[model samples]
Target: MRREIIDYLKFLMGAPFIKGYRLIGETHLHIQYYSEFEEFKSDHPMSEYTKEEFDQYFNENDTLKKLLVGESVRLLRQFSYLECVTIEIKSYDRVVVEVHSSRFILNKYFGFNIEDLSLGDNTWKSMFVDVYLADPAKRNELYEKIVCKFNQ
Candidate 1:
């Protein structure tokens, strides 16, 4: 799963930017776009998942989904404050994003159950994932779709 996630991200290496939302609460959803994303650092390095335990856990899951570009993704807001969205390459509609939070020492999981989420919670929020296509001609089409869905 770790390698699969990295590979999906790498597929966007040539993309100019990626854009998505940061849901603050029930009433607020903020747009957070990133340029120079290839240079952006991941707070929790992928190395953490290399441990034998995580490897076993990943292998045990016969249904682990693979991420892809343009598909909606869900992640646990456990490691970082930045809200993120990722596309799955394969799976039955399960997405998990983990962001590091300075407020907690232990890594936690969110989005396990949608009913468990609360609007006022600062550490967690749900969002969609979008990646700018590397081809300039195709970007406008996607941009228009994004505007219609998010910009309102």
Candidate 2:
């Protein structure tokens, strides 16, 4: 199930996702990546929001959700690399929620991109669906937002 879920999440990345980065999710419950949005990372916004807080903000903001769900997600193409990412079930109906992984845990234990290094001189980044979203639902709800060409 873990591999299957990862495949599905990777599918969200489609042909645009570069090798090395990972997609973490479970069925239809949660999905996310560990990259910074180019817009946010451009000036180095230094997000004041933690994973939970950032998730809550996106879940509650309709405008932001709309932006993500519609035809404006192309802005993700500006980032060089996504440092750390994880997806969790805020509320899942099918399976019992137990061991959803945390970005902090992945970063601390598994060394999930702590150095913030880019894959290859920032030629093509993998900040696809996983990095652009906070709430997993927003990702599912916003598939149309993807507009980045996978030419790199």
Candidate 3:
């Protein structure tokens, strides 16, 4: 998943000014992106997925559904049900306009019961998945920067 995320990020950072993006640590998840584009910089706004929205993410797609035959979504959804959106959206960022984020963390396999999650207290694991998080305005600003960087 990490490799896939990086590959996708690299593919999206096709802007010319972007020298490249590198990994950063200390925080839960971090990546440093270098850009020759004059507008590029370290400051960019990032976003987060609310608790309810995160729950919906898992409810829509359940891993157990993979066990079904033919792999059709209909067949998968017939039996399996999502108690909660197990994936906790810790953070997300947008790399370039239209493209995905630079870094974020999502936690999967949350909750206690398969049918329903623990309402009061549930444990979750932090998953450093692919993607970035940024507000639309920030994303546009970043996108413009990427375009400028690439165009130069």
Candidate 4:
């Protein structure tokens, strides 16, 4: 699972930038890429409409909405930023992704029942994994390591 997670992180490194991620439920995370669409800024015709009116117009106009969605997709694909990856894992106790100045860390925990079941024997084996972002100078030091890996 660690290797699989690493591979996924490596795959994400191909993108120009990671826009952000949305956590759906406890086990699924969707990571989006930063797109040129986000950088598009102009005092154009579209800017004339108020935010509420713009949303209402788009909501009412199916054809226009589809056209805009298609165009946004086209632009994202053109820049190779179209792909969004969803990471799903089961029985994960906790997953921590820490981003520091130079690197990031991906930590995955498993086997501990955060919510204990009714069964008498609730004790279970646990596993803790760490992906360090910064090189440790001391034996106990841990730092962010993944962001640097992505940046490289």
Candidate 5:
């Protein structure tokens, strides 16, 4: 399962953004854009909105709509390179995703049923999303890879 997890994360090589969704105790974390929307690019005007207008603009804007909740802002393109992703198999199980262009570090601990690889909890899912979104390249390779793994 650990090897599977590492293999699963390899698709993060050039992801553009990551989004997370949680319902009750169930959570999902996956790459945003899914690589299918790479041809479309929308620029969001961050400086144009006031606090109230920001919400209104976000509601009406297509670009903002694509972003996950609380991710209304964008990351600079300079932070696209992936430094390394490390999995630590020890007394306790964990994984660390490190980014080369940003200070963001994602640490996830093992949850129930590693064989499933969902690893959904309050913190880990969001962290996974965070790391996924740090890169500005979009490709659904990660999603395809994971789905294929599960299918096997």
Candidate 6:
């Protein structure tokens, strides 16, 4: 099932554009692409909203609806150069999607109690520092070690 989900995510590589997304409570996220939709559910057991709060917010919040739907359209417009997507699975049902082009990168995280997205430039420094290393200091440390070992 994990492999299947990963394979499905590869479809985003050349997808025309992202349509929108739906958040059902806090457990399920449904993402609509140009041609299809995919669903992702959380494996953790925790609710971000109470039943009463959820009902009230869902019925009364235009901002929430606009947030989920409008963001996709806005993102598509902003990152017209996006050509490929790379998926990093932190855990079962928890994934980070890196969408990139020659000039920019957009990272979107989905799973558990988090749904976050960030955009940055596709620079070598950014890739080496942000994507590859969790701790920025490790890059210099690793490089020094590699150079010392290679010289031996």
Please tell me which predicted candidate would have the highest lDDT against the true structure: 2
Model 2's alpha-carbon lDDT is: 0.32
For each candidate, C-alpha RMSD in Å?
16.5, 16.5, 18.0, 18.2, 17.7, 19.3
TM-score of each model, paired residue for residue: 0.20, 0.21, 0.20, 0.20, 0.18, 0.22
Expressed as tens digits, the lDDT of each residue in 1-152 for candidate 2 is 34543353444421121113233332123332223233233333564544454344333444334333321222112221322222211221222111232334333542343234344554223443344344467454433223221111
Candidate 2 ranges beyond 4 A from true positions: 1-29, 32-92, 96-99, 111-115, 121-152
Over 4 Å off, model 3: 13-16, 24-29, 33-152
Runs with alpha carbons beyond 4 Å of true place in candidate 4: 1-10, 37-152
Q: For residues 33-150, what per-residue lDDT tens digits would candidate 4 score against the true structure?
A: 3222222112233433344443332233332222222222222222232232232111122221222211011111212222331224422111111111111231113221211112
Error of 3 at 64 (Å): 40
lDDT of 4: 0.27
lDDT: worst 10-residue window of model 2: 88-97
TM-score for predicted model 4 compared with the true structure:
0.20
Whole-structure CA lDDT of model 3? 0.23
lDDT of each: 0.27, 0.32, 0.23, 0.27, 0.25, 0.29
Tens digits of per-residue lDDT, candidate 6, 1-152, equal 23433344344422223334433343223454322112211221253433344333223333222222233323333433322221121222343222121112223321111112224444423433243333435433322322211110
Model 3, 1-152: lDDT tens digits are: 24543454443222222233333332121223322122232222132323343233222222211111111111112213211111111112323212222111101221122223122333111110111112344323333322211111
Model 3 weakest lDDT span, ten residues long: 123-132
Weakest lDDT window of 10 consecutive positions for candidate 5:
87-96
Better of 4 and 5 by lDDT: 4
Which lDDT value does model 4 have at 46? 48
